[model samples]
Every structure is written in structure tokens, then in C-alpha cells.
Target: MINANKTLSLAIMSGKGGVGKTNLSLNLSYALNTGGNSLLLMDCDLGLANLDVLLGISPESNMQDLLTSGAKPSDIVIPIEQGKKFDILPAASGVPELVEMDEDMQDLLFSKITELVGGYQYLVLDLGAGINGTVLSFAAMTQMRIVVITPEPTSLTDSYALIKVLHSQHNVSDFNIVVNQATNEKEARETFNRLNMACEKFLNIKLKNMGYVRYDPAVTEAVRRQIPFIKYAPKSEASRDILNIAVKIQKIRMENMGRLSERPVMKKFPTLDD
Candidate 1:
């Protein structure tokens, strides 16, 4: 069991839009939560929030309600598989305004979120594609930023653009990459090598490999069913790979925090001392 205080925030990003970023986010979260730490998978894709669809849950209230109105985090939080222990806070309900949150609003949300962070060990923020002002700001703010990409040249090119913005604009050197939709292990390694080489040559940033997920038909079927691949096909190839990724992330977290006793857990609102 995780201690009920510490929190870790991970922003899940992608170079291109349809590279299975949400799939990886949700499944890895489920895997991590299985290890005893409470997980809050925040759908940070403000404009096109579909994390709920992926989890097969339609949220009644989301972050948008809290941001536009004066709703508290607890009021908007939707419990997914309540007894299972992991929860998700969907983005604003209904059509997204896409108005671009102002600096004042950003500051207000950040302050409130800090209080909410105390309830969970990990807050996995699934950011949208492209390096817009908002995405870059959130990426720079987080302790860890994961850039997801496929093996396509176009995908790698866009990823470079993202890494450039992060380095030049945010001065963020902490980056990790996960190769999705790879044909096999060899393809995944080659893809990581291509991107890793470029970052070293031009940006002077060394990217860490967080492992890869092979292309699996079960993943597509799970999407069709509007459920996480991990839950839909626990014995499938992708599910096994997701379990590995989860283990790797847990190891990295332990290494970063220098603690192996237990992970952190988010608790009830207002009761958090930190």
C-alpha cells in the first residue's frame, strides 16, 4: 500500500494525435494501480477529451465544470470501478469551449489542483498533441513528461518539433519516449534510436526509453468496445507489454524518489495535510 501523502505527476504526450497515447495512459494507470498505489488519470486533452470513452464510462461532471464554474475537485471527480481503487477526472463536460484558459484561470486551477494532488500517488495527465502554449506550459510544469510516438517519419519529425519547443521554450531536459504500434522489438528499438540520435545531435537532450508496445489486434477490438485493452484482453500481447511498462515506471519512480517502501495515495478532499 502507498503512503497517503506523496504525489507524482506524469504528463502523457504524443508527437501526433492518433498514436495510442490515451491507450497507453489508461492501461498503464490500471497496471500501476494494481500495484497498490492510488491513480488519478486526468484527461488533460481539453479540446477533445475522450479518456472516458476509452474507459467505457461517460462522465457526468468533469474538470470543465470546475474551471468554468466554482465546482470543487471532489464534486467533478468520477469514480471508475470504485472498489478497484483507481479514479479518473474527465475534462469539462459537453462541448469544450476551446477559449484558451487565461493566465489567471491557469493560476487558480493550478493552486486548487495542488490541494487535490495530495489524494493520489500519481496524477497521469494525458496531454493533447502539438506544442501549443497550453500544452507546453503543462509539460514544463510537470515533474516528468513522456513523449509518445510511432515509427513513422512524420511522427518523428513532429516529435522533434515538440522536443525543440520543450528545450528552447521550457528548458526541460527531462524527457522519456515510448514507441507505440511497433511491428516487433527490433522496430521499436530502431524507432527510438532514430529519435534519440537526433535529440543528441541537435537539441543536446538524451531521451530515455520507457519500452514499447507492439501492434496488437486486441487493442483495436478493445477500442471498438470502448474499454481499456488491459481489461478487455488481459492475456493479449499488448496487455502483457502494458504490464511491463507499468513495472518499468514503478522502478523509475522508486529510483527518482529513492524510496521502495510504498507508493503514495491521494486521499479525500480537505483532509489532506499537505
Candidate 2:
């Protein structure tokens, strides 16, 4: 059983769609779980929820049910990997209104989320791509914000745009970058360096290169098989890359915990409008 305490919340977001944000989120959750930490992966892509689709499970309840029916958070959570590891809060797909939940509603939902995930060690939010009010709000609330990008020019442009928006609007300075689907480490470093230089020159923000995942055919095969690449092809290069990233995340958390002992106070959760 997970200890009831403050859970480390992480939002995995991307500047544009099809950058493998959701796939990375799922695999990262599995990697964290394999390390013996309980986690909750929330599908925050409200309108097009498909984390369940990836796992090949059908959820009877979703975020809409929790909102409309006043369902207990536990009632809506579904366990995966035989209930021994990760739990998921599925979202209703094709519900356009859910994509733009107001500030009060978002706050209310997160309060419930805080309660529901308090026992777990981490809550991973798989946010929708692009910069929108909903995405900004959720990303601002989390302790760690991971921005996924690729080597494509469009991906790089949109990612820098996202960082600028978050920084200027929400005062979010610290950001972790993950390069996905890179052909090689050289390509990955080149991508990160380009983005890093841009952010430093323009936004004056330091972006950390969390790590990069190599493009692998096994990722597509895992998707087709409806299993996470980490599980489907544990020996694949992409899986190993994700595991390394997960380790870095764990190390970051530990270092933050040590710092917290000195500070002994938590930062206020940023309001959606703030």
C-alpha cells in the first residue's frame, strides 16, 4: 500500500499533437511503477481520451461521471497490471465541453484529485498538446512540467512557443525537455541545443534536457499490440531510454525532498487564472 502523503504531481505535455507525449507518459508511468512506487496516470486529454484504448481496457466510469454523478474518486479509478501497480483516471472522449473546464471547476476537480491521489507517490497527468487555458492551468499546478518535442521544425517551433507562453503567462520558469523519436543521440542533442539556445536567447529560461528516446519500430508494434512499449518490448532501445528518464525523475524527486526539509514549506498551488 502507498503511504498517505504529498504526492509528486507531474504533467507530461507537448507543444503539438503526435509527438508521442501520451505514449511517453504511459511508458514512464510503467517505469516508475516497476521501481516499486505506486502511481496514478490521469488522461487529461479531456475530449479525446484514449489511455484506456492504449491499454486495451474499457472503463465503465470516467471524469464526466465523477463531475456529474458526484462519484467518489476511487470509484472512477481503474487499476492496471492486475491492480498491483498503476491506477488510471480515464476521461470521456469526444466531449468537447470538457476541453474547456472553467477555473472553479478545474480547482474543484484538482482538490478531489489531491485527495484521491494522496496515498500514491506520484500522479502523472497526460495533458493535451498545445497551449490552451486548460493545459496551462494543469501544467502550472504540477511540481514538474515535462515538455515533449521532436526534431521536426514544426515541433521545435511549437515547443518554444509553448515555453514562452507558460513563462510569460504563468511565470513557469523551470521546464524539463524530452526529445522523442530521434534518429540518434547526435540528432537528439542537436534538437535540444537548438531549443535551449532559443529559450536562453529569447525567453531567458534554462531548459534541462531530461533525456531522449530513440525512434524505434517496436514503439509502433507496442501500440498495435495495445501494450506499453516498456512492457511489450522491454529490451527495445526506446524502453531503455524511458527507463533512464524515469531514473532521472526519481533522482530529481529525492533531491527536491532534501531541499524541502530545509525549507519546510510548500509553494501555493497556482490558481488557474494566476
Candidate 3:
């Protein structure tokens, strides 16, 4: 179980699109909420938002309404289900300004979001693919960062690049790795090892392996049906792997609870109390 005193914020990101980063974020969130812990899944994909689409929901208001119309954060949050303690702060798609929001706009969003932080134990941000200034800033704000990758040459190269930028520019050294679409456990380890080797040698960073999710047809069906794979096929291989990963991550969070200090590097994203 997570500590209630503070929210364990995690930013799930990727180097490129089409790597199942968003899907992993959605399902991982559901898995983490199994202990009746409340979580707020924020779609920080900005200009290309789509968490609402995957959940088969269309909210009346979103982050846009809060920033532009002075809407309350409570009014914009959409509960994933009536009884489940899960909610998502969906973002607007095709919004140009949202892609590269000015520092004032970011501060406004962060301030508004901080108002509701006390109500949830988790704040899971599904960031847009690739590394932009917005992506780096949001990724740094979170206590944990999970980089999703597949067993592809491009994925390895691009993911390394993303990690490099964060570590070199933003001073974000710690990162978690999630291997997606692996055919088997051996394949998954090989993928992680190859990426780890590159990082260890060149970037001088060690990535915590959060385990892997094998390719499963159930995932495709779940997406097609606009539902999470964990809900769609609870007994599936992919679902099992994700739940296991969630357990691993929970253990990590518990161990690091005492050291979950706020990154004081980004002056623009300071806490309201700061």
C-alpha cells in the first residue's frame, strides 16, 4: 500500500509513438488501484490527448476548461467508474498552445492540480511521446519516470536519446524501464540488457527494470473495445505481467517513501508551499 501523506507521482513516457506507452500507463494504473487506493490519471499528452478515447469516455470539461474558463479542478476530473476510486484529468487534443505551454500556463495548471493532490494517493501522468521542453519539465516534476520500449533497434536508440536529454538537461537521473511487446521472457531481458548496456556505458545511468509485457491478442481486443486489458482479460499473460509489475513498483515506492523529496531544480514547477 502507498503512504497517504503524499501522492506518489509517476510519469510514464516513451521515445516514440506506437510503443504502447499509453496502453501501459492505463493498465498499470488499474493494476495499482487494486488495493482500493485512489489514483488521478492525468493525460498530459497535451496536443495529442487520447486517454479519454481509450477509456471510452468523453468528458464535458477538461484541462482546457480549467486554464481558460477558471474552472475548478473538481469539475474537470472524470471518474473512471462510479464505484472505483479512479479518475482522469483528460487533456484537449489539437490544442496548439497546450503543446508548448508558456511557463505561466504550466504554473497555473500545476497550481490547480496541487489543490486536489491531497485527495488521491497516486498521480499518474501519461506524457506525450518524445522529448520536448514540456515533456522534460513534466517528467522532472514526477518522483518516478517509466520509459516504455520495445525490442526494436529504433526503440533502443530513441529511448536512450530521451534518457540522455532528461539526465543531461533536466538532472533527472533515476528512471524505470518497461519492456513491451516481447515474445518471451528471454527476449524481454535481452531488450532491457541491450538498452541498459548502452546507458551504463555512455549515459552512466542504471535503469530499474519494472518487468515486461508480452504481446497478447487480448490487448488488441481490449483497445478495440475501448477497455483496459486488465479488465478485458484478467487472466491474460499481459495482464498478469502488468499486475506483477505493479507489485514491484509498489514495493519500490514503499522503500523510497522516505526519500521522495521534491525536485528543487525546476523553479517554475515548485509546490504551492515552496
Candidate 4:
């Protein structure tokens, strides 16, 4: 289904690697796609992309192909299935220069993205770690930004650092936090609250608690089996948590749309009641 005015681009980011960024992106995209929303899960990790690996397919060409050869967005799209839900998009292989694509290439990337967005309700960009050019650019370009962090002290500190970088470099004030790999609901809530507190106190920015994912062995098994954990173990804790996260995201988008609908439009009176 094509929608010219309904695309919501969300960039998934992390302060550091090994924080389950790719896994969250995959599962969340799958869960969001469940309600008949056209989703495009792009591996904007640029160099060292692995979303395709999680989905169990190696594309002949990826984002690099579209960037260099003028390939259409549809040319490299790959489908992924998580039980009954699915989405499609181009993956990024370990291309050395993509992490630092030049301004010309960046413009081309955005142009291609515009073409792809016409058909997707949501475009989930799975970005790489840190505040490098790649991650920062994706975060800046996307309409929604979700930062993934765990309960570890280092993770919290680095997440703050990431927020500081985005605010300083890109002027991105709004952010959402996802507490990944939490042990329990209480732990997740506490972790998210602490981070939100820190952001409010220090950065003067309000960070929304997007949702959390519980730690589960099925995550590793799914990685080993080259499938999303939600599909690999639907009844697992992680899968259920991801489903809940998706619901929260849906509600947020719906609320945002509702607010837009409430806006007053300036109407022009007909000249002569034609």
C-alpha cells in the first residue's frame, strides 16, 4: 500500500555496541508490521550491517548498490518474516566508506529514502553504535529517535553521552528510551526512570519511556538460528515484551495523529458563494 503522507521514520540508536540494537530493531519492526502497517526495516548501520543475517538472507546488493549505481529502492528490498508479520528493505553490508558517506552520497541516500517512504507506514533504521557521522545523520534525519540502553552503569553513562552528542551536534531535543535486556518489569521501569531523571536534570530534555525488552536465552538462539527471536520463540519473555513495546509505539503514533487532527486550519471563505 502506498501512502504519500503517512510515513514515520524511526532511527534505532545505541551509545555502544553489544546493547541489542539490531535485535530490537528487527523484533520491533516485525511487531509493528503485525497490524497491516507497511514497514521498511533498513540496516542503516552502514558498515558492518547484520539485520539481514538476523532475518536469514544475504542480498546480492544492498544500500551501497543503490547509492553508487542509481538503483531503485525496490531493486534491493528483502522480505523478513516473524511468524505472520513481515517487512522489507535494503540491508547494508560491511562497506568501509558507507559509515562516512560524502555529502553527495548522503543526499542520494535521502532521495532514495523518500522514494521508499512512499509505500511504508514506518521506516525503522537500525543504526550502528556511537555518535559517528552515520549514526548521527540517521538520528537527525528520522522523525522519531529511540535510544536503546541496558541497566549497566556504563550503558547509562554512555546513553547520556549519546543524548548530549545528538543535542549538541544535531539539536535533537526529543528522544525515547528503550530499556533492553532487563531482568524484570521493575528493573526496566527503574532503569528507564533513572535515565529519564538524568536527562531531565542535566540535559533539560524529556526522554519518553518507549518500552523495554526482557533478557531471554531465545535471543541468542534466534541469533544462532538466523531468525528474529519473536519468531524463534514467540512465547518467550523477550517476544512478549517486544509485542508490548509495539503496542506502546502504536499508541504514541495514534496520539500524535490525534493531536494533529485537532489543529485548527485557516479556512478561506468562498469569494462569492459560487
Candidate 5:
């Protein structure tokens, strides 16, 4: 169990699917856990839950069970790394009802999440891709929102669209950008700069570059083997990049702690009225 002080909530989202969002979320959680933080990784992709598939763990129950059956959050949490560092709340894949939740359901879901995350140092939500209502609600509530994108023009455009929605509708200003599957640091920086310029010019939002992950074949191999790349290939270029980003995240948390004596007030989950 983590300290009872306060847990930092982070939502990792993408503008579109197949941008390696789930892969990055899993590896980043592992890296943060290995670096001595207790984390709860929630697979918020209600329609397609792949975190359990990536880890080769078949969960008996998931967020769907919790929402539909009134199951306790503790009942669905699966421990990882010998139950020492990380826990995962898997989602029910291909469940249409879990995709677009109504107001009451959303409130019930986040209430359970708040209860479950109390003992965690960090709660990492791997939200579904795109700018759906559920995704926007989770992103708006989190203390840190990370938007993952690639060098593809469509990826950049969709990411900007998501950011714009969050800014205009949800009043979210701060965002952390991660460039994934880049060939080199230069490519990653170029991608971030392009997105940053657009966001600044139109939305007037500044996106902090959270660094990038290099394109590594080992990542594909690890995915094929259903193992997290950080553990499967600790020395791989992609794993190294993830670790660097984890370090930056830890530093950001420490800096935020210094500035705020009390726990930051998280935005409430959006209701139907919202």
C-alpha cells in the first residue's frame, strides 16, 4: 500500500487508435513502479481492453463487472510484479454498453475509482482513443493529461483536435505531449514542435514535451510475447526512453508537491448535465 497522503491521477490518452498508446501506458507504468512508486493502471478503453492481453493476464472480473454487478474495486484489481509494486484494473473488451456511459454510470464509476486509488501513489488511466465524452471526462479530472502522438499527419491533426476539445469544452489547459515510435530524438522533437506550434497559435495552449520513445523492433517482439517491453528488454532503446520519461514525471510530481501544500482539488467526473 502507498502512503495515505495523496495520489496523483494521470490519464494517458491519444487522438486516435493504433498510436501505441496502450503499449506506452503499460511500459510507463512498469518503469514508474520499478522506480519505487505504487501505481494502479486502469484500462479505460471500455470497448477494447488490451492491457491484460499485453501482460498475458486473464482477469476474471473487470470494470464492466464493477459497473454492472456492483463489485468492489478491490475485487477487480490484479497485482503485478509479485504484488509488490503495481496493480491493474482491467476493462471488459468489446462490451458495447461500457463504451458510452451515461451520467449516473460515469459518477458511479469514478466514485469507485476514487475509493480504489486511495492507497496508490499514482493512478494511471489508459483511456480510450479519440475525444469521446468518457475520454474527455477522465482527461479533465486528472492532474496530468498526456497526449501521445506519432509523426503521421493524421496523428498530429487528431491530437490537436482532442486538445482543442479539452481546452474549449472542459477548460483544461495543461497537457504533456509524448512522441512515440520515432526513429531518433530529432524526429521526436520535430513532431512535438509542430504540434506545439499549432496548439500555441490557435488554442493558446503550451504542451510540455514529455520526451519520446524510439522505434525499436524489440517492442514489437515483446508485444507478440505478451510482455511489457521495459521488463522484456530493459536495455532496449524504447525501454530507455520510457525510463527517462518516468524520471521526468517523478521530478514534476516533486516540483508540484513543493508548490502546493495541500492536495490539489481534482475536477469531478462529468455528469449528464455537464
Candidate 6:
């Protein structure tokens, strides 16, 4: 199907690396892919791909095959966990820079993905850190963009820089913020407020607080075991926080589906109409 837009495309991205963006993406995927919801978790960090390592699954085809051999999205996509309900499109093998790559190829790749993902209910993209043309382009197409940050000053600054670029360059008005590795709810809220304050004061953008994941040792253990923390430690503090975030995501999913239903024919690629 061409230009199908049935999926609630959500990008779980960050301003910088080492903020547990990939781990969040994995757990979030597991949390949301319940109650008959079919989901696709894509590792859009082609440069420094690690979702495969996080999941401890080796796919036969990745983005490298998609870009180099013109592999279809359907061909490259694999189940996030074998015998499981959700799916994931592994990252490319080599660091293929989007700016360096041909625009036509980039268009074709995303266009194919947009077309292919329509069969699923949700598309969760774990995009690369920083502000680049490739990352921005992918970010612009999703229905929801969640910027995962931390309690660090550098994380806040870099995330703001990312928010600035997307707002100024792409006219992206809305962004969802998730403060990962927070010690407590107060700290998470304060971290979010600092970033939101900067956006409101400078960019005139009001950010959404999607909630935060508490710092938990279970997270480190889960990473070592190459498993989603939510599955590894269902009762852990971080898992509870992520599950709460999943609730907010489900609420938005309903709203997004409603919006899609209004259109006569869903477009191939969807953007923030909110």
C-alpha cells in the first residue's frame, strides 16, 4: 500500500548519547506493544547503531541492505523478539551519513518505510543523537517526537540545541520531553522545566512532559543481559516510570488514530498536525 498512514509514528529521540535513549526505546516498545497492538521499533541511528546489541538479536538484513542493495522495508524488518508480537528494523552496518548520502536515496528509503509500516499500529523510531539533516528529516515525519533528556546540565543544553534547530529550521512547534535517569519526580520535573523554560523564553515553544525514568540498578543489569528492563525487572522503579509513560502514549495514540480517520486517504508520511 502506498502512502498508508495507519500507524502512530513516534520517535524516541535525544539531544545527545549516553542518556539511555535506546534502552528507553526498547522498554517503551515492550510496554506499548500490548493489548493486541502491533508495533515496529526502528533503530534510526545508522551511524552508531546499537538497538540490535541491546536486544541481543541479529537480523539477516539491516538499513545497510536497504540503502546499498535497495532492500524493501518488509525485507529488513524482524521481530524485536522472536516468537513475540512486536518488530524492529535494525540499524545500518556502516555509518552512512545522511548529508553525504544522495537525497533521492534518502527519500526512497523513508518512502519505502512509510509505505511498509502502515500495516502496524505503531512505529517507534530510536533516532540518533544531535541535530543533523538526517535526524531532523526523520523527526519531522513522525506523529509524535519524544526528546529524552537527563538531569545533567550538558544533557539539558544539548537537548535545547536540538529543540532550537528543529523549531527554527523545520518549523516544528511541539515536542514531548522525557527526563531519563532522574533520581526523583521533583528532579525530573525540574529538569523538564529548565528545558521548557528555555524553549518558552527563546523559541516560543511549550514542551509536553511525558514523564521520566528513575535511575535504577536494574537498568544496568538489563543492559548487561541485553534485555528490556521492563521485562527484566517489571517491578523496578524505572520500569514503573516507563509504564506510566506508556499510558500517556496510549492516550495520544487514540487521538492520533482519530486524526488519521478524518483524512480521506492517509498520506504516505505523517507529520505533527497537532
The TM-score leader among the candidates is: 5
- lDDT per residue, candidate 5, 145-252, as tens digits? 889999999999999999999989988888899999999999999999999999999999888999999999999999999999998999999999999999998887
lDDT of 1 by residue, 1-274 (tens): 2343357778889878989998899898999998898888888888788898887777777787787778898887777767765888888534545426656766677666766776777888888888877677777766667899999999999999999988898677778899999999999999999999999999888899999999999999999998888889999889888899889878776665633223333221111112
**What TM-score against the true fold does each predicted structure earn?**
0.90, 0.93, 0.93, 0.89, 0.94, 0.92
Candidate of highest lDDT: 5
Error of 1 at 123 (Å): 0.6
For model 4, how many clashes? 0
Error of 3 at 77 (Å): 0.3
lDDT of 2 by residue, 1-274 (tens): 1232346778899999999999999999999999988899999999989899899999999999887788889999998866566799999999988899898778678766666776677789999999988898888877788999999999999999999998989888888999999999999999999999999999998899999999999999999999999999999999999999999988876766644333211123321112
User: Candidate 3 or 4, higher lDDT?
Assistant: 3
Residue-level error in angstroms, candidate 4, position 68: 0.8
Candidate 4 residue-wise lDDT, 29-54, digit = tens: 88898767778788888888888777
How many clashes in each candidate?
5, 0, 0, 0, 0, 1
Cα shift from native, residue 70, model 2 (Å): 0.7
- lDDT per model, in order? 0.79, 0.86, 0.85, 0.78, 0.87, 0.82
Relative to the true structure, candidate 6 reaches a TM of: 0.92
RMSD of each: 5.1, 3.4, 3.6, 6.7, 3.6, 2.3
TM-score of 1: 0.90
Candidate 1, clashing residue pairs? 64-92, 119-265, 119-266, 119-267, 120-266
Instruction: Compose the digit string of candidate 6's lDDT tens values, residues 207-248.
Output: 999999999999999999998898899999998999999999
TM-score leaderboard ranking:
5, 2, 3, 6, 1, 4
Tens digits of per-residue lDDT, candidate 3, 155-255, equal 98889999999989977778889999999999999999999999999989888898999999999999999999999999999999999999987886677
Off by over 4 Å in 1: 1-5, 93-99, 258-274
Worst 10 residues of 6 by lDDT: 261-270
